[model samples]
Target chain A: MQRVPELLVEFYSRPGYLAIIRHMIDTLCGRLGFTPAESSQVCLAVDEALCNVIRHGYDSAPDGRIRLAVHEYSEKGRLEILIEDDAKQVDLDTIRSRDLEDVRPGGLGVHLINEIMDDAVYEHRKEGGMRLLMWKRLPRTAEPAKANQEVDAGES
Target chain B: MQGNHEMQVNTEQRDGATIVRPEGDVDLSSSSTLRTSLQEAHESTEGKLIIDLANVKYMDSSGVATLVECLQLSRRSGTTLLLCQLHERVLSVFQIARLDGVFDIVPSLDEALAH
Candidate 1:
């Protein structure tokens, strides 16, 4: 395996900062040659993961610091995203999407992250806090055909 | 950056249902606004509740959770919850979570209104 280029961003754990994080992910996905739809999916998955860190890990405190890194291996056509927070360690064993049969609010973040990303892993940092690692394999050939479908739908 | 991005929600009565249109991205930051709007619409109307997602380009699990909340409320109150105009991206979120079968999804406002 070869070392990939990485982009790192550190921000306060606050809901307001989600937009900035989403924008950063969007730009990184675009540079990786992901279609608009795929880029949006990647952004959404990252956004959900970060939100879980802020709400669950940090307990909604804005003072906690969140470090996000995006690594792209162009040769391998893979992307890795890591989100680290200095909050309490989360029990990875208990992280599961709630039963959809019982519809209700909350408990969907973990499920969405798992569904969108190719692989999702939560780890307790040896030093402190927790780290969430998510990976996505870019399609061999980007689908540009469906990129314009949203535009056409909007105009109709 | 506290209020950089906000979700806009508008409600209108269509036929016998309440149409709730949310514009912009619906993530963690804006999910509360959407939840409050949906709650109010659910409480005020005795008819169907239609969520038009045509303008929502992006939504995360928080947004999905909010909709799930509304769906549960509708079932309890015997009100129909119909979702229409789901963007391909937004719809995929529902499908990935295996929620597409849980909610009544329609392709357009007309179909939602028809039921």
Candidate 2:
């Protein structure tokens, strides 16, 4: 098995912490040579998973720590991310997609995660709580830095 | 990953385009504001619609769906809908949903309108 770089952080399931989480994801992805689009997807998926853990897993209890483990393999062109929370249990089999016509403005995280990742798994840990495992494959060949450079040049 | 607080949505018009700006966290609690704002934009003008997401700190699937609905409505109405000023976080939601190609996304409102 290959060792993958990881980042772990815990926050009270509150909206304010989302900004920090997003920044951290972007910084980490940038360092790992992820494209802008890929970086965005990872951040969103991770954020949604975290949101679920807080909102549904704990039922908005506002206690305990939510652990995030991110792994990236550049050579294999693969990324794996695991988010775990000990607050409550999530029914993996019961997970359902949010209706589009409902229009009330929430409850679509699971479906979004499933759509982006090559694979998404939900498991209830023996110790307690839920773990969402998400994975995505990178492009087989890295695109030349020409486009990135062009954006950078245009920014200045 | 943090709290489940709600998000707030606001609207504005710029250079013949309607811009919907949302603030706070977008989830089940706050998705209606976004939906209402977009619907209002659709009703108010036949002009292009631009979602300014810079101030939008967070968005979940509920939020993305609202944007998709707006896109669909625009398509039906023959109005251009652009998602502009994408915060890195919000942009992630689009990419995760494989919606990057589904909407017209630009770096900023000016850029979206200019095109």
Candidate 3:
């Protein structure tokens, strides 16, 4: 196992905390040499996962606690993220993205997360709640500085 | 990343359509505001509805859901809902959900209004 730098964050499972969580993910990915586009994709996937934990996992109660663990394995060129919540165990079989033909609101979050991340697995914690494990392969030719410059140029 | 701030929605009448421009990130925390604004636009306007997403850099499922609701409202009321100038990141979210084909998405606001 390669030694990877990890970041752990704990917060109340509230919608308001999404901003901070997004910032942390952005910074972590930026440090890991992910390009702007890749960083945004990862952030969006994690954001959707966390939203699921808050909305479905905790039933939108805003009383439960959520923990996010992010690990960057530079040697393996992989990024791993885990989202844990002590609310309810998700029925893996029932957790399918809705049919696009339906064209309705809700149920799109899971699909977006599954599409952006390389791998996503859900496990019911023995103690309580559920844990979501998501992984992404960091591009080997990540040019963080150039990506930043491009974003800056776009903004200007 | 844009700071944690409430979403700001501004509405205007443009070329026989209601143009709603929401600035800042749209997520679970701020989707309701957009929802209310869109509802108001739907009620007040008989013409088409255009949403300019140029300034919205990030949008999650909640935001998408809100738009879906707006689309439903538009259809029921015989109004057309068009989205314009979607940021790349936001557009990717729509594409991932396979909503890109369902919604009337255009490249720019002028184009959306023209159609």
lDDT of every model, 2 decimals: 0.83, 0.72, 0.86
The sequence of per-residue lDDT tens digits that candidate 2 reaches over residues A38-94 is: 676677777777777777877866676788777665556777788887876756768
Query: Interface RMSD for every prediction, one decimal?
Result: 3.9, 5.5, 1.0
**Candidate closest to the true structure, highest lDDT:** 3
For model 1 chain B, the run of ten residues with the poorest summed lDDT? B1-10
Off by over 4 Å in 3: A1-5, A141-156
lDDT tens per residue, model 2, B72-106: 78878998888877777677676655677767888
Tens-place lDDT digits, model 1, residues B11-110: 9997888999998888888989999999999887878999999888788888888898899899889999999999888898898888899999999999
**Alpha-carbon runs more than 4 Å astray in model 2:** A1-5, A73-77, A98-104, A138-156, B1-20, B23-58, B65-115
| Residues forming the 10-long window of minimal summed lDDT in candidate 2 chain A | A140-149
Going through the candidates in order, what is chain B's TM-score? 0.94, 0.89, 0.95
- What lDDT is obtained when candidate 2 is compared to the true structure? 0.72
Which has the higher DockQ value, candidate number 1 or candidate number 3?
Answer: 3
The order of the candidates by DockQ, greatest first, is: 3, 1, 2
Clashes counted in candidate 3 amount to 0
DockQ of each: 0.45, 0.23, 0.71
**Which of the CAPRI classes, incorrect, acceptable, medium or high, describes model 3?**
medium
Among all windows of ten consecutive residues in candidate 3 chain B, which has the lowest summed lDDT?
B1-10
> What tens-digit string does per-residue lDDT give for candidate 3 at A86-114?
98897889877788789888988878888
By DockQ thresholds, what CAPRI class is model 2? incorrect
lDDT of 3 by residue, B46-87 (tens): 789999998899999999999999999999999989999998
